[model samples]
Target: MSGASPRGPSVADRGTWPSPGAEAAAHSRRLAGVIGSALDAAGGWLSFADYMQLALYAPGLGYYAAGADKFGEAGDFVTAPEISPLFAEVCAAQIDGVLRALGGGEVLELGPGTGRFAAGALAEFRARGTPITGYSLLEVSPDLRSRQQALLAASDEPPVDARRIPPRWLDSLPAPFRGVLFANEVIDALPCERFVMRGGAAWRLGVGRAAGAARDDMPRFEWRARPADGACTGDAGFVAAMAQRLDDLAAAGVTLPEGCCGEFHPQLAAWVASLADVLEAGLLLFVDYGLPRTQLLHPDRAMGSLRCHHRHHAHGDPFLWPGLQDITAWVDFTALAEAGVAAGLEVAGFTTQAGFLLGGGIEARLAARLAPPTAGEAALGEVARAQLAQGVRRLLLPGEMGEAVKVMALAKDCGAPTAFALQDLRRGL
Candidate 1:
């Protein structure tokens, strides 16, 4: 938010769901005609991944790059962080454990969406009496950054040491800082190159057009890149590096707009390296929905976690609505752990949300919410009780966000002991 002010960033420029059934079919016809001819010149058929990237990230025509309502009741899926205040409250509790253990430090957040998570988390942190210098954010999108700014109007100053770092410069981790570097649903949003495993071959996905479609689209994808001799071992390190591009971008000063099409972060390793270097003694708490490399390339997931979110319907095709929907892939937590270790950070712990919450003394908190009041008033207490119950049901039930997501904490050598309580949960895993 410093330096030059954000450029004419006005989110009101777009607001509305897409209705492309009729128009899309018509547009598809025209695009297929032009695009098909181009593809026919090269060869035939486009891989699903290629087709997906162009549909989702292609400059002016990709899904997320388009102008669609991405979050809330109108968008695809709602993250737990987006649901209610409870998620932040729980996070506040968890962070308190970290700060208390570390004595004191800062809280830096990456890709804080619309400041909702920050608002909730900061509020809870304040309520818990945790001493945080301020909140720093590394945002890539001007629109989202502005939105986050407006949302946190009260704590107008930099949340901590506010800075606009691009996504590709992960090495710029603020050094000598003792605190928590927290990311909520951030890793999954990192760009990733997708590979499809077919007949034991791992081929990268890219876009090229086909000449025979009724409406020839632009350069669609054709899996022309030859695969490695054997099946791809799922290069965890390489994938991590790629995903870290956003972290690197934080410092690189890349100007990303609403409609620019580009590849997903392909530089995760560098990002991790930066964090490891600057984290003198602190925790890297990653809360996201990701899997280890094994599960990522499992036969069932051979196609990779590549999927497009259009009107909330996830599909492999990104062309459903250009500059409208979200293009995201599943993150590999196992890969993240590997990257952390490679960067000299010890993998302190990993567990499902249920495990983390339960391990972090959530049971006691939940019990307190339900404990029968001794001298409380009457109706007011009952209403508060109902709300508390609602939070528990939404956050703890396995069928909900509870068991669906996972939390991982990586730490430097000096900070491992403080994370021990929660680390115990992932011991047997």
Candidate 2:
């Protein structure tokens, strides 16, 4: 068996259905048509990457493409920026250094969820007297773009120029552009190719109709492995990367242990290359929950990190609620470093989010925010103090987002920033 081990029943069997009705079923049928058509084109099987692409970006029917809340308490999950202002404040410190080194440039952010991070970071930059040419957001979803615009407009930050780059203009990005680029929780959303190790060889995992399911409108998806001899998988890079990962596992005195499953992101190199191609100079910083290659592909994660988030509940079933929930996989920092270096960018530093925040003065910011007024000054409010403390703990505690999320930076021609200098984990990668 390929590592694409079967877990359990379909979404219907789980009893966690979302918004059931004729309308919802019709929506699924329409979206499934897109996926089914592609499956048909691929000879009744589509690579997991293609399946994921259709499920998340298929015109106006995919999850990200649909109108739905996807952040904070109301959304599937809460990001660091939403958890506290200190995250943006600390991130501002890092961005400030990069901007200062480049003598000021645009701040290009990818998938600016809720625009909360931008609002906070931009406000901090303004407080620090930093010069920002402009703020450009590259978002594909119209619904999300609207939310971001509304959030930014309501922010207390100064009136800074912020615009969304049109899809047509992505290929021909502004030339000679020099600025700091940032992405938060974006890598995990990138489509990954799933693979399983069967008997000593890796097999590509694909999506096809569940066995013996006759219904076309509500076709259940199942993990199916492509045949040997590299036929029908269509992604040579994915196969090669998965094979390399397996070899690495063997080198570490570990075997796939029959039925062990894992994932490989074949598009990471091109993704980094695209960013590096347009970014003429300056630094690129990305924050996400991931690990070094060794731990990411270790036997401990035999089932891989593929996950789905729906109404704050996480499950491994990506086939549930097709265009409603969020689907993501843990990032592999080693792949990121390799891609960045291959694109001619220098690896500045890599470290835990906790280290990055502390080194960037999150604690100082927290203290100043909660400091008592002296000499006939009023003290901070009890309720406000408690809330701030909660956010701090969530952001810095070892078991929380702190150690779970990682901070990595790639510089075009500058040195490592002090934020990451606090604890560089790049050597491990």
Candidate 3:
């Protein structure tokens, strides 16, 4: 329920597999032992948050921190950027509007995987005559950063002048930006805590086992009784459970050897603060796949959106492939909104990709430009026609990325907000 309300299966029944056996089982046991040993060295005891950090952020061995192919057909899954350049084309169109509003500015992007999104956006800007002054990318991995440079080197634009700056990681955002800052699917990378409601209170869920080969690896989803006052029980219950779990771990002197973790990025607020500072007179557009606080705080969303992707198999098993998986969680848009507000950025607009694109003339653009010519005109090849049909379906169909993904924008030091035609979905923020 925390996500877009995945209609495929009941979340309660998802990722509840008892255990794996044989070779896989043996590997799981070894991994658990290794995890415990590591945690013992770190501090003798570990919270679920600390466990997740090691599971996903352990130097050159953690999931994303490792040199694993996490995108495209060769990787665990394919993001829109890897699918084609078209995704960026549409995105660039939106960014153009923001930059123009800000009197023409630059761009700063985060975790631009393989650099395709940034490249495509830059190309679109050049082709559309947006006088972009500079482009900056903040990626952590040295390997991925180099890969991004190599990918962008093939740009068709004349004199591709861009800087691949090292973003202050997990700490602070750069200050005083005057351009359109954006990212695709970047918010999901933030950490989140997992808890289960039990005994009239929420109990923190940790990724560990009782010396039984780590039977449960996913967050044990739970719900607390709705409070009579309807206060935000989400944080209240979560904080309570976390405190109790820390107490228990301390009491037993047990260290989380090896396991996954769930956490929300308090750093998100910090990042937003940096964004507000640098955004002298421009807009910040963040596009990703997630819901708002209302949906996340829904009664049904007792379990959070923390999942792992490996070999195209989506689940909540961060321990399945230590150095060969992509771990992610749903972003708290409400948290993001608060971060923006805290930084003094006025919440200008928010909405889903479906509503935003449609309102911004997707259908109108298609009707005017994508029209089929008369018989007298030329014709596309069979393959071309097939590809076009598929492309149209992908961008317009409701069930696809057309609706599931979302777009949000915040502005500062601007004139009265000029209404852009896009579905605004920030109320939940």
Put down candidate 3 lDDT per residue, 65-109, tens digits, no spaces.
656566665566556666545667667777777678777777778
In candidate 1, residue 206 scores what lDDT? Answer: 41
RMSD to truth, every model: 11.1, 5.4, 8.9
Off by over 4 Å in 2: 1-25, 159-173, 214-216, 374-380
Sort the candidates on lDDT, descending order. 2, 3, 1
The TM-score of predicted model 1 comes to: 0.69
Q: What lDDT is obtained when candidate 1 is compared to the true structure? A: 0.56
Quote model 2's TM-score: 0.90
Of the candidates numbered 1 and 2, which has the greater TM-score value?
2
Stronger candidate by lDDT (2 vs 3): 2
Better of 1 and 3 by TM-score: 3
Candidate 3 accuracy as TM-score: 0.73
Q: Compared with the true structure, what per-residue lDDT tens digits does model 1 show for residues 128-226?
A: 677676567766555566667777775543333223321121213455678888887777665566544334333445445423442333333343443
Q: What tens-digit string does per-residue lDDT give for candidate 2 at 1-429?
A: 111111111132235534546765677678877787888888887889898888887888988887777776766667788888888888877888888888887778888878888888777777777767776777877778888888887877643634322111121345557888889988888888888878777878889877776474576788888644656756667657876776776777777667778776778898999899878888889998788888887778888878777656667877765777677877899889999999999999899989999889888889888888787877889987888888877778876777878889988987777888788788888
Error of 3 at 128 (Å): 1.6
Highest TM-score, which number? Answer: 2
